[model samples]
Target: MQRILLIDDDEQLGGPLASYFQRYELALTQAVKPSAGLALLREEHFDAAILDVMLPEMDGFELCRSIRKDNDIPIIMLTARGEVMDRVVGLELGADDYLPKPFEPRELVARLQSMLRRRSNSQVQDTQNELRFEGLSIDPARRSVTRQGEAVELTGTEFELLHMLASDSGRVFSRDDILNHLRGHEADLYSRAVDIVVSRLRKKLEPLDCIKTLRNAGYSLALRRLP
Candidate 1:
């Protein structure tokens, strides 16, 4: 069974979620605080973690970063607000995805399965192990990125976005296409979702002008620098 860590103050959310996930053979380990979640992470190895944005002391964003500090474990954040800004912030903080509260339990399970599928697919590719572009290197097996020989930490979603663009360098990817690649399908996402992720990604890949934003068209990878 796949072990999943769920960090949320709403104790009620745990019971139903746990029962629902059992259908998929996924086990849920619940934590009501950020500190407890962190401790659980240190004590056990979970396949993925789910965090709620509104937590005592440490918010989900901080908890997300705290987890990313040393582990590449996939993360999905739960939020009651469901605002575009909230999703943007969570994604910027390196969350693999987010689930709005009062959501259909089915949706959460689907996303969780999709997230796990993508993470598993990234490993053990037969064609190649790494994507090289100019001064950047992406190792899918390790889920790591390095620019100019310096390690660039990326979330699961960010790594997927970068890999999509770098794998097909110079190809324009419409917002829908990018969203489809990042998520399981082309969702009716707040258009800003793509922009925010791109903006955040740009900041991390600074001084290296590789990603290009085409007005009225889409985005593409244009690595001007040669490795």
Candidate 2:
């Protein structure tokens, strides 16, 4: 069973969601406060996390940032319905995905399943060779990236986006294309999310102009591959 941590202040939300998740082979653990949630994350092994925007102690964005500091666990942020800025900020903070509040339990399960599947697929396909560029080295099997001989910490989503571009260096991937590649579906908000992820990626890969924007076209890997 896949283990998931949910950090939300809704006192009554946890019990029902936990019961629903069980039917899909997901074990859900809940933390009503950010402190408790952070503690649980530090102490336990969870495959992914679900964080609500209106969390206690700190908001979900802050919690996500804190987690990204040391962990690469996939995170799904729950935002207020129709709150575009909330979703955008969550993605900017390194959330892998987001579901608006008052969501269907089935949809949440589907999202969790999709994330787990992607992680599994990446592990299987990325085991053989490491991709090397001028100043970047990507070990797919280890899911590690090094820039300029220094290890660069990246969220799961960031790593996946980098790996995708590296696999097809110089290919101009449109925002829609990137969103589809990373999340397996296209949504209106996802296009903007792609841009945010790319921006974050560029900063992490700083002083290395490896990703280039193509005006109205898309983005491409601009690095010279080391053979």
Candidate 3:
């Protein structure tokens, strides 16, 4: 059984959801407050987490940040606010996925399964070629990246995104294409998560601006390094 942690104040919302998740072979542990949730996370090993955006005192964004500081577990944020910016902000803060309030239970299950699949697929090794684009180099075996011979620190997701793009420099990957590639088929086809992640990646890969955004189409990596 896959262990899932749900950090939401509303038992009304979490109760039935937890029951429903069990039907899909997911075991859920609910934490009604941020402190308890963070504590439980630190003490236990959960395959994934569902964090509510509207929590008491320290909101979900801060909670998400705290979780990322030490752990790389995939997170799905729940927000009542249907704003695009809210979704973008959550993604920027390192959430793997987000679902708006009043969502169907089936959709939530599909997303959770997809995220778990993505996480699992990322760990599988089919090939481990060291990709080099001039001064920028990626060693898949070490899962490390270096530019100009200096080590670059990247989040797991960020490194995966960069490695995917760098692997095929000429291919223009649309947002859906990249999301599906990273998060599997059940990924949201129109979320701004890709753009936010890409923006963050650009900042990290700075002084080596190779990721190029094409208006209306998508993004690509410019292999021609700057001198």
Best prediction by lDDT: 2
Better of 2 and 3 by TM-score: 2
Clashing residue pairs found in predicted model 2: none
The TM-score, computed over Cα atoms with residue i paired to residue i, of candidate 1 is 0.91
lDDT of 3 by residue, 1-227 (tens): 99999998987877788899999999989998999999998899999999999899689999999998877788889887567676778889888788998789898888889878765665666657778887798877777889889988766677778888987887898988888877777665754778888988888778887899988888998885332
Query: TM-score, each model?
Result: 0.91, 0.96, 0.85
Least well predicted 10-residue stretch by lDDT in candidate 1? 184-193
**Candidate 3 ranges beyond 4 A from true positions:** 139-153, 224-227
RMSD of each: 2.0, 1.3, 3.0
The candidate that achieves the highest TM-score relative to the unseen native structure: 2
For residue 105, model 2's alpha carbon misses the true position, in angstroms, by 0.8
Cα error, residue 182 of model 1, in Å, equals 0.7
